[model samples]
Target: MALGLKIVLTFCLSFSTLFPKPIVCLDPGHGTKNARHGCVDEAKVVLAVALELKEQLKQNGFEVVLTHNRLGQDLKAKNPDQDNQKRAQIANRAKAFLFLRIHTDSPSGVSAIYYPQTHPNRPLAQESQKAACLIWRQIKTVLPKTLPQGGVLPESRTKIGAQNGDLLVGSKYSRVPVVTIELVPMSKIGRDWIFQKKNQRLLAQKITQGICDYLYSQH
Candidate 1:
């Protein structure tokens, strides 16, 4: 009887360990007035992507949180990384498995940001870097190849490029693997092509696929 009980307990523990709770924090960068590009605000584009990503993740059995949803009360914060503290608090409490900051790029095109391996606050785990690379590669594979502007980005030499230096906060305070994806140029194409409703929806779908591939591959 004792032996049977031990075996059953061990089996249950293994099952639980193999299927740990998964949570994701999605942040939409920038706000309305001071967007990276004037055509479509970074806030608007990112929020669109975040909502779609949230839906996709939910379907895949993951809990999702958005740093700035439409119903959010306040968009203004004096802190450099405005919502970094709040994001970190939520992720820590939920024990998030991944943190993704989403934004639409300037007329420059698609790029993803990861904390350099040397960054002081970067998680010391090799697995986190591996996860970042996986997501980066997946996004690179799916974005429109016809556009010369989009591709995986080399790490920034200085953190300042991540927007007023506060950009580093995503990777810095992240307890789990973190990545920020700047998707496509807001103005490179013609006005009709650039702001077409269909194009934005397609972009969101591709991003959701990238995130799903990354997480599923690890399992």
Candidate 2:
């Protein structure tokens, strides 16, 4: 290589190493086709929350990537397993530091944090849980008491995951710290509060803070 070319390349490499922005992948789970909570589908609400969270994260000096094509685009899948894997692949290919899957649950559901099951062969399970706990703690401090908190839980603890050795497809395939935060239940109280514009922004701010806490702890 030419001497000047090599020097410029070396400088670029060093600069990137010192100032690389951490990449965060946000997967807004479910959509229009998803189960209807009252008048709105699950996807409609989650899309709103994810979009707000994306803006918040960007403002906090992180590069955020959405698995969907558009702001509220819902990716299609022929099968359930494929749908989950496709979402995880987007994060894996981006090599994101964290994969945050956002969703809302039924009336009885609690706002909870779920981490993947520990796997002897997979190194990230433990780290996933560690990150989850930190995010959970941070969120708890900010989220209002009106929203019920379910605390941190292993993936296996959930019903759907329990059938698969406690591992969700996304959780099993993710190469980075993966956590799911179910924001609210479908009940009247949960809906009225979460759907409010101010609350969505507040939720975004809180989630961003939680992510910030986990990222800082890593260093």
Candidate 3:
């Protein structure tokens, strides 16, 4: 190699080492069994949003991975236990900077973010809470008029918990910072609005902005 070319390659390698690409793992909640209300399929909608968010993140120079690619597939697991395990494994193996699980709730106009109440990985849980708060604030700012007045919640705040009192399967198993974003209280009117293609795109854009804001703030 020419002397000048070698110097340039060395600098590029050093820069890559100093600032590795950030990998984000996205889990779109539910699958085929999860019922659809009106014209909205919860699984399908979340997956759509996830796909858009993935692209947005990529454009921002972050590496993004989805737990599952399609609507019917459930992370190649036979049961829920295996499903969650597989999801967590994907993030853990990727050494993801963040894990975001997207979900939507019914009876309209509600939105909230959640973090694990307590976990063996306490530091990770704390980080999750911090990210959740940041993302919640951003979402509230963007959808103040449309979503319900909800705040970031810890898993312990709710009575109904996921396996082993974790409140969410992916949250329980994840070793990385993780949060679940639930767009909820979907009243009849809210459902109609959410199913619109334009609205879906807008929602995706807001979420991408929030994630970018959170990541940038950390650095």
Q: How many clashing pairs per prediction, in order?
A: 0, 1, 10
Clashes of 2: 1
Q: Write the per-residue lDDT of candidate 2 for residues 16-54, one digit (tens) a residue.
A: 367787888998775523221323456777788889999
Which candidate would rank higher by TM-score, 2 or 3? 2
Q: Across residues 1-219, which tens digit of lDDT does each residue of candidate 1 receive?
A: 245334433443354457864677877765522222323555666676677767756655566877667733354544545455556556666677777776655555445545435445444335456666656664565455554443444235323435534435556666666666666656555223435566655655555555555555565
lDDT of 2: 0.74
Query: Which run of 10 residues does model 2 get worst, by summed lDDT?
Result: 31-40
Give stretches of model 1 more than 4 Å off.
1-20, 32-40, 121-125, 154-167, 190-201, 217-219
Q: RMSD of candidate 1 to the true fold? A: 8.5
TM-scores of all predicted structures: 0.70, 0.83, 0.81
Q: For model 3, how does the per-residue alpha-carbon lDDT over 151-176 read when each residue is reduced to its tens digit?
A: 89887654335436755667778989
Ranking by lDDT: 2, 3, 1
The CA lDDT at 24 in model 2 is: 89
Span of ten consecutive residues with least summed lDDT in model 3: 31-40
List the pairs of residues colliding in candidate 1: none
Q: Write down the RMSD of candidate 2 (Cα, Å).
A: 8.6
What's the C-alpha lDDT at position 137 in model 2?
72
For every candidate structure, what is the RMSD over all alpha carbons to the true structure, in angstroms? Answer: 8.5, 8.6, 7.6
Clashing pairs in 3: 107-185, 107-186, 107-187, 108-185, 108-186, 108-187, 109-148, 109-185, 110-184, 162-167
TM-score of 3: 0.81
